[model samples]
Each structure stands twice: as structure tokens, then as C-alpha cells.
Target: SAEGEELLRKLPGYLAQPGVTALVFNFVDQLIHGRSEHAILHEVARDASALRSLTRTWFEESALMRALREAERRSVPVLLTTDHGSIHCNTPATVFAKRDATANLRYKFGEDLRAERPDTALLVDDLPSWGLPQMHLGVRLLLALSDHFFVYPTKLREYQGRYRGAFLHGGVTPEEMIVPVALLTPRSAG
Candidate 1:
């Protein structure tokens, strides 16, 4: 990571600047990679502990932590949040769609989208009621339900083998909906 360390070193300069500053750190890649590896090798359900441990380790060893300390030293109020959370998708649901459909496994929107197992998905034909813009006529939203991940029928076996236990988002599960928001103030500021 020495190659990438310099990029994060710039954080301090940004933090030192006057006016409201917003810092964003992306820990999703590591979480997803770790979870996918575990799912591929282990039969145990996607373990939250593994992700928690990974996050803790990343915070302790990464330059971001030093930046946090720097912010604290400067008495900079910190607000940390995530746009969305992820869920372990173990159920593979078959979906039929045209070649132009979106490829994301968690959700898809296209002129033609239908789940082979209707119970495993939620289909919304009324896009406007949901506040989603109607990109085109007859466009519908199909969301995988519970722990299900969508896989095209043409390559069901291939996709299932690769993404059966992967961590994915864009679903309606509690894990995907609920995220943490932390507001931290330095002791010196108080």
C-alpha cells in the first residue's frame, strides 16, 4: 500500500483548511472482497463478525485513522455516515430479461423484467408512485427479495456459482436499509 499511501497523506492538508470540510472514506471494497472470499470458501452464513473485524483492522492500520486523530487534534467536529449498507445474498433467483437490462444482481429496471420465482422478488410497474423517473415506456423495477440475488436464466449456473453467497446492496432488507451515523466531537472542543 506504500504506492497508495501518498494519496491519503493529502488528507491532513485538506483537514487543515478553513471552512466546513467533509471527509469520505470508502471501506466497502474491502468488506465486499473479504465477505465474498469467505462465502466462497466457508459454508457458514456471511458472518458480520468478519466484516466488523476487517473494518476495525482497517481503521487501526490505515492512514485514515491518523487523519481522524489529526481532526481530533484540530477539534474538528466529525460526522461519519454511509450512503447505504449491504446484505448477504445467498438465494439465487432466476430472472428473465432482454439483453439491455441492467446487470446488477440486487435490482434491475428495464422494459421487460420478470422473475421466474415471483415470490423471491418484488416487481414495481408504477415507477412514478415510487418517485423513480420513468426513463422509458413500460420500464419496471424488479428487486430481489429477502436474501435473493438475481441471475439471468441463460447463465444461471455460472452466476449462481460465482455470486451465490456474495454481499450485495440495493435490496429492501433491514441490513440494506439501516446504516450507522456517528457524530464525534473532540474532548478539547467540549
Candidate 2:
């Protein structure tokens, strides 16, 4: 964190003078965006061990973590959580829906939904029973299961080739449904 040491030294000054001290870091967003925009997801998906190492390294080396260490030095408490989890999708299933149907690979909410691989998706008339309050007539919910996710019938091959090894979320897999909660206290806490 030598690169961040200079910035760390300056943080206290800003915090001391600030009327309202607030800091927001988008470190996780940058990683997720890197997965989507870059080929990092595909590169890592096939190698689970490599992916794990990469993630651990990224978190340890991140400036955000450096900042956290600086805060810890000043006896600050930190709460961290994620909105959702992601899965390395393996199962492929094509779902039938209208052209204007919701364009989410993890789930689909549309009318007359049909899946080539029926077991891969959970098709319900509405989303209320699934913990979502929103409901509508003729609107159905199809949540993908396990490593399964939705793919369009048209250009299916192209889509699959592009997304087969990509990590994605918003489905019903355990990885997608479960979230982690972390409360970090200073190591020197008495």
C-alpha cells in the first residue's frame, strides 16, 4: 500500500476539518464491471482456484482495504455487506417469452413463459410467493436454479458462447440468494 500511504496521511486532515465527513468507495463495483466489460470473468470461471486467489489478492491489495487499515489505526468500526451474490453459471436453458420481455439472464418475468429445460427454471404465475411483492395478471416469474440461467431462443448459440463461463447473478441459486455480513472491529479493541 505504499502508493496509498501518501493518501492515507492526508485523510486525517480532511476528516478533522470536514463539517460532514463521509467517504464512499466503489471498489466492488469496479471489480464487477471489470468482470462484465473485460474477459476476466471468462478467464477465471474455468479455474476456480485461480479465481479465488485473484479475488483474495484483489481485496488485500485494494486501496479501499488500505483505507480500512488506516481507519482501524484510528479505532474506527466498519460494517460491510453485499447486495447479492453471484454464480459461475454452468447450466444452459432457453426460455420463451415476448420480444419485449424483461431482459435479465438470471430471471425472466413475462407472459406464456416456456423453457426447453424445464427443471432449470421455476415458473410461477406471479412473483409474490417468491418474496417479491410485485404481481400482475398474465405476468409470470421464471427464476433460474443452481447454475442454470435463461437464454433467448434467437441467436442462442452466440449468446451461449459469450456468456457460458461468465459469472452472473439475480437468479435463484444459493450463491445468488445468500449474502455475507461482516462487522469489522479494530484488532486492538478492549
Candidate 1 local accuracy as lDDT? 0.80
Model 2 over residues 1-190: C-alpha lDDT tens digits?
4655676678777545636445555554455545655775546635556666777788788767877787688766667777788787766799999875798888887788878888888887757776777756778888888887678878788778777755778788788788998878898864
On lDDT, the candidate that comes out on top is 1
lDDT of candidate 1 over 105-124, digit per residue (tens): 89998878999989999999
Against the unseen true structure, what C-alpha lDDT does each candidate score?
A: 0.80, 0.73
Model 2 residue 8 CA deviation (Å) reads 6.4
TM-score computed on alpha carbons, candidate 2 = 0.78
Which portions of model 2 show Cα errors greater than 4 Å? 1-33, 44-46
Cα deviation at 111, candidate 1, in Å, is 1.5
